[model samples]
Target: MKKILLFALILNSTFFYAQELRLLRGAITENLIVNDTVNETYSLYLPTSFSVDRAWPLAFVMDLEGKGKAAVAMLMNAAEQEGYVLASSNNISDSLSISQNVLIANRMFNSVFNTVPTAKNRTYTIGFGGGAMFASILPTFINEIKGVISIGASIGNLEILNAKQPFQFVGIVNRSDFNFRSMYDTKQVLNKLKFPNQLLVFDADRNLPEIETVSKAFRMLTLTSMAKGYLVQNDSLIRSSYNDFFVDANANVTNQKPLLATYQMSDMEKIFYPLMKLDSLKESQKTLKRSTSFRQANRSQNSYFLKESFTKEDYSYYLEEDIISYNYANLGWWNYQMQELNKLDRSAILFEKQMSSRLRGYINALISDNIDYLAADREPDLEALNLLYMIKTITDPNEYTSYLKVISTSSKMEDYGTALFYLEELLKNGYTDTQTLYSIEHTALFRIMPEFNEVVEKYLKGARYDVIEQ
Candidate 1:
């Protein structure tokens, strides 16, 4: 028994160590005249690899406060895992002064590249909340940036800038965010402009599910073949393609029913709800203006409601744009969520809810066995099981059960671990089918004790037993 316990402890410890992350801290001395004095402060993170000779692509992340270098470390770990380089810095100043922001960004970039010269021209920038505003404006000052990602930040007039230079841009927004309206409007404007940008607008109405969807989308973008274009041209089509890929990937895992339902719900709430409200407000305003008697009877009340709704709707749109800025600002929440979701089984939910078409497709691949669509290292296993659980709750049980069968069959050989894991999960959730439970127990026992015929016979005769050939 002690040996068994020791073995279990060793296995668990090995798993934990396999996922351990290491961080490194250092400072850069750059000549930036602030208050007529050249001062310097240290920035920190875990490099892609401990080796100094290997040059990795960089991601410039701002806004590190009490959060320490965890955000940068998360990105660096992801880069290391995904075979990229990320260079990040802490923009020490506060407030959204563009000049100050640009100066800090330039100094950080130069300082980071000076330490790792091979990172030049392969750098990307991510700005979060207020820092997103910095990312939008910083590009105008620095010519070396290859792409930009912004979250929950205000964009202002940044969309009007020329994107002919082939810089990729990705924006993440939430409808419940304070600046949601502005962000949505910015997305509309950018969509109209047809620049090589991708927008992930989430429904704030549902909290956990929405965040899960967003995180999944982000991961799929990183792990799939579609990421090649995202890394290169930053094309919207490529982004869209990735979205579709995730959707398909999830479909294969959960039988497409749950994803379809969630996609429909998100579209209704995130995309259509505000538009419907705006249309109603517009009609009400027109009617109130045309009818003098009605306007006179309740002028103040009518005007107040109309103006309030209109303003709220407008702000919702604005938030879409600003949200991207916040993402770029390197806010702890955004980075933390990314790190946490990356470790979970339901990470693909984040992608399915946030991305459409190709983006959705990329997420689907993460949970699927279609090796052609997925990278050599990426596979659907524990993550797919989590997605299956989520969909099982949101969709019809019978339909979900049938869907589960299909997924189990498709992934039976390659994903036996996930199947057993999810089967136990289903039992925990009150799915008490005797035959199914017995099958799961039998299969698990067989894999561990192939010579235990007596145990197999006992399972076969048990009230919860089922016989199914793999």
Candidate 2:
């Protein structure tokens, strides 16, 4: 039994050693003087047939800190298993300045390329989060960079990206992220540039495994597609690394690749990839049809009322369909469309009126009795107050009045400035019984009103005699 235990320990150690990453330490200099010592660390994994004489395409992964080496190692092992040499580094500073990050990235690239002479021009960089920012920016300096795969980074400057650079860029972002709007804006800019790029916006609430699997498959597809273009198709040996590199690298990889290909992805890719392509195609077709129809309708219509009504109806249907199909919770796009339609003509008030009920319903659902959930939703304070008032009038007036009184008292205790905002909302929404208003005024005097007594006194003077008596 002791011998078996000893053997088991030995076996575990052997397995660990076999998979252990190799780290190389170096330093980078921002200036010619080499004044600041940035500790540069990287890990390398070579394929089974790795040769000093033969050059291999490389992937340089930048990570946030120590984890960069491990992530790179995993990717490297996976790539190497597929007959590719991959290297990774974690030499970035937490400061996140573009200059500092770019310098560190250049230094890491130089260090790795210097050690492995064949890696000079065959490098692709990939990063997650801050690391993604590094990868996105590194190509500007490193002319040899072939491609980039960024996860959760802002690619804000589209003009800087050379459209003809042949650097296939891909980004993975969470749809529910606060940065998603920025991401979409970035994508719009990139799309205008006509650069070879792809953006995979995943559902933010999904697990990391779902994200990682999609990312891994995307990386493989991108690599394989490039490989196919280069006519290198013997990927049998590469299949072995798929499990080591991508298995549990995320979740549900099985059906994802096939789904991506159904929409023009000829290799292992994400299902969303094809869906986006199809969506884009449909949008383009709809836009053309709408423009043509609008022109034709405008030419035939004698009255402004008919033309305006027709346009608003068409836009309303389009936006409603988009919302239902995408399950978009926010009315930002609808608002924007309505605003544009309003600009085109003054008579498009119907769209705005139609959206009021839907918008109010959405706000109420968001603020529904669950305070924790309401807080989690992070509804704007003013909006919350407005909804609370609406809830008071529409659902339970007594409860709403009680809630406002409690809020007013809590605000006095906490010295919250927004109590007045809520109070104003309550007043506007007809929670204006003399007793309730007096209770609010009395609480304010002890805490908040003291700081602004003059304003409160002026407000009280304007109040009705009944309210003042209360």
Candidate 3:
């Protein structure tokens, strides 16, 4: 396999790279100045099992912003458990083109590869959300990135995907993630292309994958390594992981989490098929599916998935239309939709709750995507950003940052009335970061106004500015 051989090559890279590399083993340390000219940096984690004698597999974690430390922290436990070297860049940016980001990631890769004895053939790209999207495509540009572990995103940069550069892809997503359907769809495409891949559907938000779920993804990589002869097959490790996963899936079924159990069965089937015959696994899968509880749960989840897809389409169409028209009047409609989501979230049925959560997440992601794209322009439409931020406040009510952005944008435009209104709305909705309110850009004069102080005093009991009654 092209993917297998690529990883096998990394094992042969010389000791020239290892002796010079100084690392704090067993803990992640921020490599503050890996590339000084561009000020590129990364967070590196060396498992306690790491040794200088052998080159180790590398997980190059990609963060959308310069959050290398946090990203590495997310996977550090799994890396420790799996004995993979972890490096996450602190320079990937949303403003950069896919090519530009890949170039930046490559620079970080060079820094790590040269400083650390990483198995060149076993290198993988890892990311969450936008970072995941970026990670999935890096293999196309760089031949050495042999696999992609994407949490919360499906395959990306499709136009550039080269069949010759095919790599192992392990996609991890939650059932309620907006990307759930897309991840499944990508599975079909990967199957068609004969790309070695697995999709693990766990139960959590896109950003909150449990450590067990993440470790399972890494385990798949290691097992692939064994299959490729890069590492000696450890049947004990295989049995232990398979048993852990099987127990979790059975626990899910026992807990009435049929959707999660079924998804786990699929993951189990793909992950172990390369290592051994899957007759027993297949039989277990059939037995689980044959259960009336599993059947009913599967039907409900599928129905909700369809409904969730359509609702997302509606949200996208309306959001685009509203953004194009600057339709402030439609704010009420958006608010109403959020209210409807709340109803679903409160529904007695499990499927409706899942669908509602996904829809809420989808709309927020949609608006945030639009906001980022618009704000990246040299002459960004401030009005649209403000509108999207307002809608964000409705969809994700507790994200105080959205409320602050709306206030800042409105105040910058001298729409004091609008700014003051959101100030009150934000406070009414339980925002109490008084210091942050005072520091919002373009709100210096706005924050000192009588109405602003009045609203602040009314909600938080102490206004920074003396509100002189007019």
Q: List, residue by residue over 1-470, the lDDT tens digit for candidate 1.
A: 11111111122222111212222322222222222243543344433243444555566666534122544553444444444444444444554365665675676666555544344455667656655555665655677876566676645356446766545456666633435445655656766665445555544443112334434333433422233432333346444534554454344324423323233233323322322233542343344345554344345433533543563443334323333342223223323433442353243443322322222222232223222222233563433343433333222233336334523542444555545444444444445445544344225543333222223334343332344445
Model 1 score (lDDT): 0.43
Q: After superposition, how far is residue 363 of candidate 1 from its true place, in Å?
A: 35
Top candidate, metric lDDT: 3
Better of 1 and 3 by TM-score: 3
Rank list by lDDT: 3, 2, 1
Q: Which regions of candidate 3 are displaced past 4 Å?
A: 1-21, 32-39, 468-470
Per-residue accuracy of model 3 over 1-470 as CA lDDT, tens digit each = 11111111223331222234346677777764565578777888878766666789999998888789899998999888888899987888886787788788888888777666777479999999889998998888888988999998998866667777789999988777778778888888888887888888876534578887888889889888877887788999888888888898889888988767877888777777878788877997888889899888878877877877788888999999999999999999999999998898788886787778778878888888898899889999999999999999999989989989999999999999999888888998888788888999999889888889989999999898787865
Give the winner by TM-score: 3
Off by over 4 Å in 2: 1-39, 47-53, 65-67, 70-84, 117-121, 154-156, 164-166, 174-185, 201-470
After aligning candidate 1 to the native by TM-score, how far in Å is the CA of 183 from where it should be? 2.6
Clashes of 1: 78
CA lDDT for candidate 3: 0.83
- Alpha carbon deviation, residue 411, candidate 2 (Å): 19
State candidate 2's TM-score.
Answer: 0.42
User: Candidate 1 regions off by >4 Å?
Assistant: 1-37, 47-50, 64-84, 117-121, 154-156, 203-244, 248-470
- The candidate, 2 or 3, that scores higher on lDDT is 3
Error of 2 at 286 (Å): 14
